[model samples]
Target chain A: MRHTINLFLMLAAFWLLNSGHYSVLMLSLGLGSIVLILFIAHRMDVVDHESQPVHLSTKLPSYFFWLLKELILANISVVKHIWLGNSSISPTLTTVKASQKTDVGKVIYANSITLTPGTIAVDLVGDKIMVHALLEENIQALETGEMNRRVCQVEN
Target chain B: MDVAIEIMSAICLLIGSFLCVSGGVGVLRFPDFYTRMHAVGVTDTLGAGMILIGLMLQSQDILVIAKLVMILLMTLFINPTASHALAKAAIHNGLKPVLDNKERNNTESESSSR
Candidate 1:
């Protein structure tokens, strides 16, 4: 019930924002579409905690900001290596142990790795994520386990 | 105040453009398939993000800004998933990443499990 309300509010906001006109006819049409979409969504059976993660709400902002910093720093390093020629790069593929227990947590960690410029999470098997890094230190950064810890915080 | 916003916006857009071009360069210059994926990832994440933020600063309409935020969020979530999929598929197809010489011998042995 809470998840449904969450989805409804999100859809309502999305529709209201996208459709600037608030005329009687336009609003009724928008409300109808929203109901129709909600019905389809309920039938699809994806309206669950994973879809509307209310628990992560408070923690997400800090994590997002930290990720943004990580992203910029990684970008700077990558830009430098890109100009420094192929020899400057040390392409390393290594599997890192994901401390995340939940599937959502594991996914967050893997996606965070890929979002950083120099590293890409190639494959996830069990709790291990196969990572491809453009530089050795980038993999070292992952091994340092700060990102993994933050993701775990988000999940728990 | 307005000028400051414009200045920041320009800076962001400029940096975004530079990152995007750098990504293109990295794509061409990098040795193999896997390293090149990182290059493209840079283009979409911070590059597109900065560009959207820059656009957001310039726009007055709340709706337009909201839409730009939506695009940025979608890109952030989608790009990594797509890249991960591409990387996994490539690996499954026996696309080995070019690694340092120290680990070259071990690479073949480890790939069999993935």
Candidate 2:
């Protein structure tokens, strides 16, 4: 029920932001569409805890800021390697162990790895994620578990 | 100051353009599909982000800024999913990444695991 309410509010805000319409008829139609969509979503059983992730809401901003910092740094390095030609890259593929307890946490960890330039989380099987990187040092960086620990913090 | 904001916006846009072009060069210069993906991923995340941020800095309307933020959020969420799917598919199709150094020579690994 709480999740449904959350979904409704999110959808309402999304509609208002996108629609820019507040008339009686437009608003009524918008409300109708939102409730109908919510009903369908509830029927599909998709508005659960993981889907809405209320627990993660407060923690996401800080993690995102950290991620943005990592992103900028990674982008610079990858761009530098790009200019340095093919020989400068030392590609490495290896598995990194994840300590996240939830599926969402694991997804967050894998996505963060993939989001950073020069590294891609090729596959996630259970507690291990197989990563491919343009530089061997990148694999070492992942092994340090800085990102893994941060993601776990977000989950908790 | 408005002048400072304008100068910062222009710098952001210039860097963004440079990153985007570097992505294209990386894609062409790198060996294999996977390595090329890292280049593309650079463009997708920071490249698009820097551009959007430059746009945001230049925007006068709050709604425009909100929309730019939404675009940024969507990219942050979706880019990885798309890259992961592409990579997983390549690996499942028996594509092996080229890895080694000091004696390395090859753009695409000339090996398939099938």
Best by DockQ: 2
Instruction: Give the TM-score of each candidate.
Output: 0.93, 0.95
RMSD of 2: 3.4
Q: Compared with the true structure, what per-residue lDDT tens digits does model 2 show for residues A1-156?
A: 889999999999888888876899999999999999999998899999989998799999999999999999999999999999887889888999999999999999999999999899999999999999999889998899899999999999
* Regions more than 4 Å wrong, model 2: B101-103, B107-114
**Residue B47, candidate 1: how far off, in angstroms?**
0.9
The sequence of per-residue lDDT tens digits that candidate 2 reaches over residues B1-102 is 999999999999999999999999999988778899999999999999999999999999877888899999899899999999999999999997777652
Please give, as one word, the docking class of candidate 1: medium
Candidate of highest lDDT: 2
